[model samples]
Target: MALPITDHIVAAVSKMVDDSQVEGYREPSHSDIEFYVSRAGLTDADPKAQGQTVGKAKRVRAILSWAIDNDQTAGGKLVESLIAKVRASGGFRDSSANFIGADVIARAVEAFDSEGYILSSDGALRPKNLESLMGRELTVALRDYARRAQKGSEDAALLSGTSKDLLEATAAHVIRTKYGSYPQQANFPALLGQAFIALEMATPEDPPSSTESPYRVMERGMYQSAVGVNRLRNKEGSGHGRPWVASLGVVEAEAAIELAGVIAGYMLDKLDNR
Candidate 1:
């Protein structure tokens, strides 16, 4: 069976196929004969069975010699050279979209829809189908790109390379600048845990970064909100309530966590505070 990679195919591909476009196919096309020998290669003809057709030309070099011997234009002859170029190899053989005698190849390319594979508002060949693919295969390419980018974000979120030791550190910076310290507690792990959650909750397009648990715009913005905030939350209440203060005791940063106090006022008893 004919495969995409073959010496003859390579030779034929070399003659007309734009070397830059074909990725990694190179062959010597010195004259008309070389061109013919190479052009004959584009078909699915078997090297052994088709040997009789281009007879005794065994290799691409031998085929070129034969073309020079019998044909004046070498073996470059084809029913429609341009259309043939598109069938055997994608891309335009010549500057013109028209192929010999018919526009079969060009028309087929133009037939595709924009998203499905249009002729391209600019006259570039778009891969309409996976019949032939060079370079990166587009079959699962877009999806793979998404996965790779997502994986990168997850890694960055895990890094914890920030100044603040709390979730949404970036937001904390802004909020701290305005409100002294963010309402977030100075706890390390709890804030970091929230940061991780923030990063995970982030859309694939944008992720949260920082030391604190990125719960909102802070999570969606920069800063998981704090360092180890996520770990602190997970260590205790699955990641729900007040920021855990990782210290000798609990000390609020610049501002007090009135919410924690509020909950304490409601669910948490005064004895529990002790």
Candidate 2:
């Protein structure tokens, strides 16, 4: 069977980055597709690829694309971390000569996410239907490494997939501008010179944000045990940073980013009225 959708995205991104290099481009370190590979499968190469020097990173992206097409509920960094572990293990052992590399296992994880949680008792990054967008991105990022590897090479196949995706995205955007009603935000992340500084707990030593925002308690406490007063401190303590949150595509955690935005907006409206 083909891989999932998240994997496909990874493949496309990887290709894009790979092809970019041929244009005498120097992509940023974080932008390098390889940074995402360990999560989207495609760890080691097969006997043919191993010796023949096929791009392992490209293969990883290919596998990742397969996963994305098949799965959407998956997302976030936690799951990415798990896929990373599997890739580090040198792929999985199979009964037949056809070894199930990180790519194959990643596909399985998508299925597991689609079905429900697929973790072992040890809580390792096994299958789980509790899809998280964070996990999905994590997968895409890893799978893309393969494309990066290809772009690094002089092969025609390098970045072939990525070029197609960019063209598609551009075309789609044009069409949307001409026909669509709901317009996209001109600035996607923070606009202009805005920067996002990260803050978090200091582990066993520091404990500042344990009760900062009573509002967060109402927001994250659902589908979770950490609610009420506990959420407040952390909310304010993070120096007003966007608090770390989880996704729900993993069949667990219940947070619609858009919905959250809507609610916040409504509250803001009410405050203004008052």
Candidate 3:
């Protein structure tokens, strides 16, 4: 169940939009507004309802959703702030309209463009999905990773040392925390391999009688992928100096960084559960 969105929530959100002062900030389109209202149970519950109606709660949720989705920088900040407040007040409910607070929604403002899944508020990283995978223990590390990845995603020139360095560092940190120690001088790829193996062992799975278990097989494949990422990082990443002519393109940088984030997130999450 979801917490009540309430008339007060609507008024508060309206104030935020008004205060933003972002030029040409879009208000919710009629269709979007209708959809939100209908989703919030503000419509007639009749199966054969002829017309749609909206209450303050539904209207507010729709507008906030539009703002958070479209004008991320300004709108997302406002939404995050509101969510923080509501959560502090112990107000969370079950329904999409009622579930106004989401970490990914707040974090999406830090992304470069809206095109990529690198910081999308949707897909595997929706707020509830993350909460299920992560607890308070891993919040700080996850947040740090998000901040670093945000910088890497934003840097089109790929010279800020944000992408690859952060990815590698994050993997090392997760490995160290999970295993209680990491090889003093192990490279990023090695650390990543060690981390995945540790996570696999931590989970209780059926022992294979002859052939390797699915867990071993999966981790092996992931280890190979990590090595490839490390190679990419070495050649065109934020590591040691290369020839002046060697340049890191945005695509390569993002792919490496995103892969690092995925690997780190998955391992850390598994460790937390174990």
State which candidate has the highest lDDT: 3
lDDT of 3 by residue, 1-274 (tens): 1122223333444432231333333333334334543543433431224344544344445555554434434344434444344333332332333333443334332332222212233211222112222234334436545444544443221223233343454455566676655685877656665666566542123243456666665555556655665565544544335411235675766766666555555555676687
lDDT of 2 by residue, 11-39 (tens): 42343223222333322222223344334
RMSD of each: 22.6, 20.5, 12.7
1-274 per-residue lDDT for model 1 (tens digits): 0111223322332333323333343222223323443466523232433544332123433443444444424233421242244444334444433211124334433333322442322233233342233222421322222232233322112112222212233223333333444456645434333333332434224543566454445333322223323333324432233334445134332122222222112211211222
Backbone clash count, each prediction separately:
43, 58, 5
Off by over 4 Å in 2: 1-3, 6-11, 20-22, 28-35, 45-61, 65-274
Candidate 1 residues lying further than 4 Å off, grouped into runs, are 1-49, 52-108, 111-274
Task: Choose 1 or 2, whichever is better by lDDT.
Answer: 1
Cα lDDT over the full model 3: 0.43
Better of 1 and 3 by TM-score: 3
lDDT of 3 at 35: 52
